[model samples]
Every structure is written in C-alpha cells, then in structure tokens.
Target: MNTGKAHKSGLRVVASHSSLWGRFLQGDRHAFAEIYEAHIDDLFHYGMHFCQEKERVKDCLQDLFQDLWSSRAHLSPNVLHIRYYLLSSLRRRLLRALRKDRRYQHRESWEAFEFEYTLPQENQLIINETIAEQKRLLHKALSSLTRRQREAIYLRFFQNLRYDEVAEIMSMQVDSVYNTISKAIGLLKKQLPLPLLLLLLGK
Candidate 1:
C-alpha cells in the first residue's frame, strides 16, 4: 500500500486547514464558520462509523462545536488535519455520552466501538480506472474485514492519515496500527486477484 502521492496530498490539506485554524484562533468569526462548514460533513460521517445513533452523533457534533468555541482560548491553535483532531475529540465526547446513558457500561474501552464504511457508488469507483468487476471484488474484501481492521484500513488508506495520525485517532500505537492495516490488507489479498487488490487499495 504505497501512497506517496496521497501522503503528499495530505500535506497540502494540512497546510490548508492549519492556516484556517490559525485564523480561527485569532478570533476571526468567518474563519470559525468556514472551519465548521468544512468539517461538519466529514465529522458526521466519521461519527456514524463509531456510533449507531446518528441523531446522537449530530447532537454530539453540535455540543463539540459549542464546547470548542467556549474553550477556544485553551484549544490547539493549529493542526495538520482538522478532521483528525475533530474525530479524536468527537470520539471522547461520544464515549462519555455512551457511558452516561449506560449503553456501553460493559465495555471499558474504545475497542468495543463498531465501525462500518459504506463504499461509494460503483460509478464513483471508476474515476481511477477501476472497473465494475473490481468494485464488486473490493466491496467483498472490505466486507470480510472485522470492524477494527476495516477502521484501520479506512483511516490509513481512505482518509490518507499518516500512521502516527491514525494511531492518535484510533488510540493505538504506531506499530500496532501498521500491523492492523497490514493484516487487513493481507486478508483482502487472499480474496482479491493481485491486480484487483492493488487497484482497489492503491486508489
């Protein structure tokens, strides 16, 4: 899973968000709104992956922004990927909410969270020359993965986060994140032909 180009693209995204965050921290109200608008959809999607209650995720997102604004002075002034920070923050809030509601009292850790990734439409998959047959195989391979494995792969490949960034978001060690994603890919390899596997993953 070589993504040198994708990694470089992440650097560009980092620069973009970091500048916006700096402006927001400087008390620019418009920058703050822009930041919220930029991330709200992504935050909602990521939150849905971890929690079944979509409405709760929406409420938590509202609360997250409220709390962030209230504590703006104490917040980090810059970030490479604002979504990573938002996801990290949102996870804590949602987990606490779960505990408060006694829904996950039996689970002591984040590992108990379940994740599901809905693939884009078949036509969407072909933007990179992937065919309909490849998309079918890719979906099957993705479905075969455990929730944690799928999450690791999603963050590492789909989200284009660095291993360290993914580690922080997923509350895993860097080495562990590497291993998880590697195992996930190994599983996919067993199910897909070599070319199809690379095509599905490399995009």
Candidate 2:
C-alpha cells in the first residue's frame, strides 16, 4: 500500500493514535507541540546519557527536531512509534558531534565523573528528590561501564532496539553487538550489590 493509505489504515486502529499521528503527518503545530511535550524528557535523558554535555545535548535535540520536521513530508503515517526513530537519529547526531568536537574526546571512563555521595532531599517538584540517592548510585554504576558497554546497554534497555538495529547504528557486526550487551549486563550484575540488583530486576 502507499504510505498515506497505510498510515490511514494504521490510524483506524485507535482514535488517539490516529489524531496524534495524523496531526504530525500533516504538519500541525498543536500536534507537534503535544508530541514534544510527551517526549522531551525521555529524549533529554537519553541524550544526556550519551553526550555527557548539557549544551551539546540541547543543541543536538534542536537539530534533531528541525531535521525531523524538514523530512516529515516523506514520513510514513503508519510508523507506529516516532520516539524510537527520533532516538536512533539522535544517536547518529551525537556520534557526529563527538567526531567533530575535540573537547568531547576525553577517553576517561564515565565512572571517573561519578558522584561520591548521595543526597537526602525529596522536596523538589521538577526532580524526583526521593529517587535522587538511588539515581546517583545507578548513574555511577552506568558511568563505570566502557563507552561501548554503555551504548549497548542504552540501546538494548533504554531505547529498546534489537541487536541488529543497534549493530547497524553502531557500525559494528551483529556478533559484536550481542557480545557487548552480554558483557555490559554481566559487569553490571557483578558490580551492583545483590539487593540493588534485585531491586533493579524487581526480584
């Protein structure tokens, strides 16, 4: 089927789905606004995980949406989830940014930048202060991983991409992706305390 027809058919599956995707396909401002509102936080966190620089992540996000809008005319309405596509695009943009910027070339492991202490605040509205301590510990653990391990973990768990998709994005062989994810998970399992790991696994 043609892109538009397929999109229309997909929309018929649900009212909420049709309205949002339809508006996005047609370049509606309010629709795009809703989309941004729904996704910005997740996107920011994902970008922060990879880029490590706040300003660079912000700039990359701006460039990402601009490119998405510019190319929206060619999009398939049947695209079930736009968030995944945007994230893949953002990853590419981040890699490009790293390649072009020398300052981002620090080869030190992210663990070197981990916070040494936990916070005891739960009064903030914007930030989930209750989760601050756990978040810091998790962040420190994540930072301890190698760059490839971090990317593999993010792609597998955070972005929810398949091994093949991750391999393609990272320009590595499928076996490499699989090995990287396995190694990363193994390391995390070993390093995290049993209780915390169980909490993470909901066990």
Candidate 3:
C-alpha cells in the first residue's frame, strides 16, 4: 500500500469511482456490481474489526449490497472516493446490526467497536533489518493505544480519509480528529524507534 504511490493512485480511484457512482445512479446495474466487487474485501475486513464472526460479516455485506442495489436510484449522485464512503457505510450498518443482536445487547462499550489494524507481514517488510525490527515493535505498540487512537490513525492515514470525513465517520469534531491523530502519532513515535515509521506505514 505504498503511500506515495497510493496518494497518486487515490486520485485516479476518485475519478473512476465517482464515474461509476454516476452510472449506478443512472440505473446501471453493472456499475453497481462493479462497486460491490471493488469494495467488498475492504468493507468486509473493516467490518470484522467490530465483530469477528465471519458469517455475520458476510451476511451484513450481502444485505448491504442488496439494499444498495435495490435503492440505487435514490442514492447520492456523486461519491468522491467509493472506498471511503463504503467503509463508513459498512461501519454504520455493521454496528446497527450488532446492536440488534441479542448476544451483544448488554455489551455496549465503545471498546467493543474498536478499530483493529495489523502490521504488514514479514514478506511486506522493508529491506533493512533494523527497520524491520522496528516494524515489529510498532505492531506491538499498536495494542497499547486506546481504541479511538487506533481508529483515528487508520481512518486518517490508512484509509486516506480527509480530516472532516474521518470526524464525521467517528462522530467527532474536526479539531478533535486533528488532535487525536496528532496525539496518536506522537504516541507511535515514542513507541516506535527512529526511521521505522515509513516501514510500518506500508510505504
């Protein structure tokens, strides 16, 4: 997920997804299916952060895409980044589904819906030994941060959402999002050794 390359790729993604969104809104079922196929993996992966149940995640996605296709004509006419919009949409629907489930009714803690992100695997590691070790340390440090801290970092950096977009998804003020990410990065810097940031960032 090279960030430098990703940043450039993101621009192309915005254009393509936006065009697909328009086509879908104009009643193109193929365009809608393209949207579903393009984002299903990331949406499902993000949903698992809230609930580990494989079937539940798959069910929710099925329902979401079904409802989305059925109601495509009524959806927004534009979407700048399909990935960002789908991630936020999936998060909302998954939580709503979890809330209705009898087993999770009593456990309403925010930690139950905490964000989870894993470090790049060994094969994805940087070429340098020291940096690779630092990447391992950073993965450990991630566990020590609060849920909100991790979510803020993931949405802002990994998901590439704008600050306001992240704030809306997390239901926080834009300023709060800025502060949270600033603090989260500071904590990561303290937890991670020098020059490992880029390696851990998947650059």
Candidate 4:
C-alpha cells in the first residue's frame, strides 16, 4: 500500500505540534485541552502496557495532565512532539509509582509489555492448520523477547515512533533502540513470514 500520504500527514502533525505546544506553553487553556484530547488515549494505552493496574494508570494520567497544565509556564517551549513528551513523562511517573509499591521491590524482572492478539471470527474460520501453527510459533518467538525488547518494539511499531523518540521515551540511546527492534524483528522472522511480520507491526 502507498504510505506517502500517511508519512506526509505525520509531518503535518509534527509541524502542528510545534504551533500547538507554543500556545500551550503560553498558558492557552484551549490549546492545553486540545493537547489532552489528542493524546489522552495514546498515553493511557502506553501507561497500561507499562503497568497493568487500570486505576494506577488512570491516576498517573490525571496527575500528568494536571501537572502539565499547572506547570505550563515552566515547560519547555521546544516540545515538537507532544505525544513523545507525554509518553516520557507518564513512563517516569509509572516507574516511580512502581518503585514505591512493596510488591514490585523484590521482583527479579519487570513484566514485558503486553498486547492482545485476536483473529476476527470470520478469519478464524478460514485460517487453516498451517496458519495456526505459524501463529503459535510467532507467539513463542515474541514471548522469548526480553522486557526491554518488547517495550522497544511496542514504542517503535505500535506507537509509530521514530527511533530517537523511542530512545528518549525509554531513556536509552538511539542505537540501542535500533538494535533492540532489529533483534526483535530477527526473532519474529525466524517464526513468521517476513512480510506478515512487518505488516502486523505496521511497517
């Protein structure tokens, strides 16, 4: 499928972000609301992946937007990607909240980012044994990935973020983000068709 238009649309959003963020920084309430309306769902989805607790994610989102609005004067005027800024801020908040929870203190490894996979009912009937086996193998390959690898893939693919943006959100180097996604794709390729893998990842 031709993706040029989608790419151009993304550029428009980046350009719009520059203007919208400026208004927000200047304490424009309408701009602040628009920013919230545009990103709240994405932020909440990301938050849920970071932490499974629904209420906790909601609380973090509430605090995040509240702080953003209240601290508008101090926020950087150069935020060219509002989604990136919100995602990064929510991540820090979730991590801090997790740290304070005694249940997570002694955990050996953090949970991997979780995303659901479901075949439509009509498609399910048409899917044969071969496809079913491939799906199983794909799940196995995905499950083999490390937590960081899963998070990197989620941010880069599911969130449609650039490597640099994923790096900043995850607090890692850009090269690390590239390598992590490469490795994740490499694993998936071993189990599923390369085209199908890329399609599922929205590449």
Best by lDDT: 4
Q: Please give the clash total of every predicted structure, in order.
A: 0, 0, 0, 0
lDDT at position 41, candidate 2: 85
1-203: candidate 2 lDDT, tens digit per residue: 13222222332223235678788879998888888888888888878877678898899999988877788899888765567677778888987988898875765546422334343343233346435666666776766677777776676566666566667777899777777777666666666676555545552
**lDDT ranking, high to low:** 4, 1, 3, 2
User: Per-residue alpha-carbon lDDT of model 3 for 173-196, expressed as tens digits?
Assistant: 977877777776667668876556
Clash count, candidate 1: 0
Residue 144 displacement in candidate 2 (angstroms):
4.8
**lDDT for each residue of candidate 4 in 55-104, tens digit (9 for 90 to 100):** 99999999999999899888777777778888989999999999999997
lDDT of 1 by residue, 18-108 (tens): 5688887788889889989988987787777777678899999999998877888888755667777887899889878987987666653
Clashes of 4: 0
Find the candidate with the highest TM-score and give its number.
4
Give candidate 2 regions above 4 Å deviation: 1-19, 106-144, 190-203
TM-score of 1: 0.71
What is each predicted model's overall lDDT from 0 to 1? 0.72, 0.69, 0.71, 0.76
